[model samples]
Target: LNGFRRTPRPLIRAEYQHWAVYVGEGHVIHLAPPCDLMVALSFYFFLYNVRATVKKGKLYVVVGNNDYRINNILDEKYEPRPIQEIVQDAHGLLGKELPYSVLTRHCEHFVTELRYGKPQSCQVQLR
Candidate 1:
């Protein structure tokens, strides 16, 4: 399990607002407009700012909880192709060939290292 910190404040602010700071004149530094003291009192994690550099000509496909075909499964019409087939189709559409072994390795790392377990209060429901 990843050892992360949890602060007294919730993860998200009461309301979302972009913020900026400036320094000039005799004043030390200050923010302008849209600044509510109540909203700014909350704490958030810095790790949420992680960034990734994806190479051009490469594409990423994501399947979230919303993508699950549970109704199709119940109706007996559910048929899902293997991830390899999906990736191959994308490569064909792009008129290029990509490395399968490398992609599989990355997928494994994403599942095991990055998202090994669900977070608290996050659950998927199927009916």
Candidate 2:
């Protein structure tokens, strides 16, 4: 991840307009945007940092203003958490180069608070 430069340069903000969180059993989610989406792309930039690497299917996330949500399009009920919390959580989880134990402990504490309960089961395998 690159930080701001001393000299001024162009910045590219993601163009995706909406975000939603769905809790389910799938390892991947299909994103689709809404019809009358009229929000700033900045509002949903956190999706860029997630860095989901898919193997078999099309595995790239980009900024598009089409009707897309990252999880699933058919499922109806979904709620999105604040982007700030997601960013901070991802920073700690994704930045550290540590053993699984260390990461899982951090995830247990952090995820519990983030979800307001203990996770049924936790797994921390680096990809």
Quality of model 2 by C-alpha lDDT = 0.26
Worst 10-residue lDDT window for candidate 2 reads 1-10
Q: How well does each candidate superpose onto the true structure, as a TM-score?
A: 0.17, 0.22
- List where candidate 1 sits over 4 angstroms from the true fold: 1-77, 95-127
Q: State the lDDT at 38 in candidate 1.
A: 24
What TM-score number comes out for model 1? 0.17
Pairs in clash, predicted candidate 2: 31-69, 32-67, 32-68, 32-69, 33-67, 33-68, 34-67
46 in model 1: Cα distance from truth in Å?
47
Q: What is the overall TM-score of model 2 with all chains considered together?
A: 0.22
What is the clash tally of candidate 2?
7
